[model samples]
Target: MACGPEGDFARSCVPSITTSGHRVTLLTDDGVRIEAAHTPRIPGPEGPYAPSRAPFPAPSADLAVVLAHGFSGSLERPALRRTAAALSQHADVITFSFRGHGGSGGRSTVGDREIHDLTAAVRWARSLGHRTIATVGFSMGGSVVLRQAALHGRRAAVAGPGEHGERTDAWPDAVVAVSAPARWYYRGTAPMRRLHWVVTRPTGRLVSRLGLRTRIHPEEWAAIPLSPTEAVPLIAPTPLLLVHGDRDPYFPVDHPRMLWAAADPATAELWLEPGFGHAENAAGPELLDRIGRWIARRARRTD
Candidate 1:
């Protein structure tokens, strides 16, 4: 059977595999309700191996990856669904709609509060009994993953118990950020200029609501949060992979380079693709397969 709209997987292309997937709604710490889908990995014969663009240490089994979509994008986007389908070859996949997009509730704070959205998804993945969990995000979601890793990784490392006396640690074991920006309030490119207008201007906000079905928050960020580059250093020990396209019209090569420079080289790997453009839109089957293999290898590692 075909996958459901919310990514409920009844059957898959691999004939010998039988795994179940379902739609779930996650409540963020801040109380926003986010829409998500969970698809367990289908165990079967392996497909062609795609070598990693960059070399890294091998890894754990039964890995789970949480996919965060970009601004104005939803879990229903074809590109994201294709990515989820491709990734399911190697691991269980969970895709979620950030607030202000798709079926999720609340207005977009652009990238600021989205960290909570990722946190909720990561927590859900952990609750599923997957010992190894990774988060893969694109564009705005990429920024969210970096910040989430930085913020929650530290908390999870030292946190004791919650208000309900349950452990509050919800950080992922690994993180992959694609086409993420190095800093906030960037308007270097025409697309970003337009995006700024969409998020900050009244008319543009209306257009976003009507044309894009995205509801952006009207107020400016009360205070500047930790930039993606700055957040990189805090994600140490946890493996990190930064992927960017040289031809990207959004943030350009400097963004990823800055992020790589800020990250600890021993624990981070950066891949600068020549022809790729942006996030999921630029992630083709070959790229996705390569990423899947890389993540699978990382998940298998004990250290």
Candidate 2:
């Protein structure tokens, strides 16, 4: 259901308009259909909207931030919307549902093949005429964004055509990973152990589907994809930011520290926030604002 005056009016009068942004369908490399939105920043303190293609960036907008939600989170989630709202203050924002989440197709591969989803979103942002792009990911998404940036790199030789024939530049000018795990198969914390069960067991997968609305793929990772620590070293020349709450329950500060140690000091920055919790839900407006400013500054500098 739509909330607030604008969303309610749009829902009642214009049934097709549910969100405060333009709805888009992104096709990943593996042919999964990813649901997405383009939220153009407006003046004052309010949510964003891009009613038509002609007024995408408005006059002030130049950069785009692609937000990747965590394991169970979706583009439609309230927390994710708030994150978009906060980031849209500085740039246009693109938020998308990973496979098996929200309205997207296919099953979630946790963090493995989800890189394709992030890559598709990045390419969509680039196609929207934003020469500069930044990616911000939370939890599982954080790991995916790190791997995506490493795989594509900023200096990718070809602007190759994607599955849909759209020109693809899967790399971003800057990246921010919040509450991401440094290495895979980490079952150190209580939450991590529960998460492992959710992905590895049949009953837990059923609970995830029925209770959380997040569909999990039952098969194990055929091949271990690149870990976040391994990916960090490859992200130099493109600015990277790793943010982890000191009180984060899932993965401790060691995760971010491991990633930071792997990254080039000149290009990578780590923020161990005080009293902050995990991912999108724990990120308040003030923290999001700071993140938006940080990315905006870094993107401009790198450009």
- Candidate closest to the true structure, highest lDDT: 2
After TM-score superposition, what is the CA distance of residue 168 in candidate 2 from its true location, in Å? 7.1
Note the Cα lDDT for every prediction shown. 0.80, 0.83
**TM-score to true structure, per model:** 0.85, 0.87
Which 10 successive residues of model 1 have the least lDDT summed? 8-17
Name the regions of candidate 1 deviating beyond 4 angstroms: 1-20, 46-61, 154-156, 159-168
lDDT by residue for model 1 (1-303), tens? 232233222211111122335666776767687887876665666633332222221222468889998989998888888889889888878888999999889999999988888887887676666778889999999999998888777444575543224334877788899999999989999999999988889999999999999999888888887889888998887789999999999999999999999999998999999999999988988888888888888756732
Model 2 poorest ten-residue lDDT run: 7-16
Residues 1-303, candidate 2: write the lDDT tens digits.
222332222121111233465666666767777888888765455645444445233443378999999999999899999999889888889899999999888999999989888987887676667788999999999999898888786644253542234333567899999999999999999999999999999999999999999999989989898899998998888999999999899999999999999999999999999999999999989899999999989988977
Write out the backbone clash pairs for model 1. Answer: 59-300, 59-301, 60-299, 60-300, 60-301
